[model samples]
Target: MLCGKGLVAGYLGAPVLHEVSIDVRRGEVFCLLGANGAGKSTTAKCLAGALGLRGGRVTIDDVDVTAAGAHERVRRGVSLVPEARHLFGRSTVRDNIMLGGWTKSRSHRPASFERVLEMFPQLKRLLKSRARDLSGGEQQMVAIGRALMADPRYLILDEPSLGLAPIYVDAILRQAAELARQRVGILLIEQNVGKALSIGHRAAVVETGRVVLSGTAEEVAANPLVVDSYLGGAA
Candidate 1:
């Protein structure tokens, strides 16, 4: 559903990603695994149109979006849940989620909000509560729920489990897997190899801004190099 071809991008003047490429097929969870600063987030930003690419191209369902702005990408069904769960601290949970559907018409928002509430029942219960009062895990749910509010066909998630407890992390990963089963293509950027591998349909390992490995989850999980590099030789 989404494809990045030979993407080269960076900040300031120095390049962090070089010729990195990956694809997320329809109904699949494609996880991008790497150490800190391996350019996973940069790749996500490029795909979401949050960062402009210095080279290569990004496409969604065959439409080139390399130069499209973030909001334009959203209108084309690309939604990103960034690394930091950027929720409005002063806004109520409902209000925060509502902002995600700002791209949709007013008549369409109620149905979208209902869908989000169904996907995240916890958020439904805290609709009137302030975002700042929620726990980290709850806030993460809000972030995901907020993205779902946009009704995206392809969801780009960067570090969804970054700071949560094990239970919440597991919950979020399972929810991500469920989303894949529902045919929502996901580009999941994660530093947590084990959890990402466990839930991902396929995995790509990025090293120094390049995709060094790519394959099905089982194939990657059992790879000796992947085991040595990221899985601690457990595979």
Candidate 2:
């Protein structure tokens, strides 16, 4: 299990997150849903160690990693695919995928690349294609592939479905489910209430940096407060 208990963080000493807590179990899809600026990304940053927490505890498989930096955390099997999908615009798909293994030993790259190819065969032919030329969906796949190359135990995805067409959106969500089934704990942040409800095993709704609602997917979807606030929103 990966967890954050009473996490608090922000920039310039101004807090954006206030005592937020979450739990992600291996092989389970634990989702965080909220509107823009709800501190969803902030929480991810704190958990993934992209930023430091003012006060909290972050543990992976019962090991305390609250003191670990981002690179150290990555080495410890945590990976983050931020919302931007920050691929090298001019690099080939293969080069981009290889970059994610920078934290690992050179000797491990080949096996990691093979594993990624197995999961996302679509990248096989696009290895030489420049990242910028690929469609949005393809770029997202490359980003995910790059993360997989690291063989992370915990994957944190921020707004993956944003700006994607329905087909691509469906594909990304399905892949997330597949990763969870492979025993990777997934902390998915999204604005798409309907989609998260459909695939999430457990869910939380963050309001003003706090978890205002959390429960099994069915329970959250049926909450009047959740429906009134987040229903009918597009990814």
Candidate 3:
């Protein structure tokens, strides 16, 4: 499990999150749903050790890894696929995927690459193609394949469905569910509540930097706030 307890953080000394806490369990998708600048990405950054905490702590299992740097956190089994796919546009897909295995020994990298390719066979044909030339969905798969190369126990994806075609969106979320079944805890940050809840076993709504609502998918789907705010209905 990856957890944050009363996390407080911000940019340039200004607090963006206030006493936020969250839980993500393996074999399940813990979806964080909210609008833009609702601190969803900030929470992901804090949990993934991409940001400094002003207060509170983050943990992997029961061990406090609050002070660890991003690379250290990756080695410890936490990986984040930030929004915008963040691929090396000019780089070949193979090179980009290879970079994700930096934590592994040279002797074991081939196996790791194979494992990721198995999950994304489409990438196999594009291994030598530049990322900038691929479609948005293909790039998204490359980003995820890269994360898998890291052998992460917990995967935090930020708005993966954004700007994707319906088919690609379903494919990405389907893979998310598949990953959870394989025992990877997924922290999916999504602005599209409907799709997020569809695969999410549990979820939370982040409003103005606080976890105002959290429960199983069924419970969250029934929450009046969720329906009113995210389901395209009147409050």
- Leading candidate by lDDT: 3
Worst 10 residues of 3 by lDDT: 226-235
Q: What TM-score goes with each of the models?
A: 0.97, 0.95, 0.97
Residue 50 deviation, candidate 3, in Å?
A: 0.7
- Write down the TM-score for model 1: 0.97
Model 2 lDDT per residue over 100-176, tens place: 99988999999999988888888899999999999898899999999888899999999888888888888889999
* Clash count list over all predictions: 0, 0, 0
Indicate the worst ten consecutive residues by lDDT in candidate 1: 116-125
TM-score for candidate 2, residues paired by index = 0.95
lDDT for 105 (candidate 2): 94
lDDT of 3: 0.91
lDDT per residue (tens digit) for residues 1-235 in model 3: 8999999999976799999999898779999988788999999999999999999999998889999999999999999999967899999999999999999999989999998888888889999999999999999999998988889999999988889899999889999999999999999987778888988999998888999999999899888989988987642
Clashing pairs in 3: none
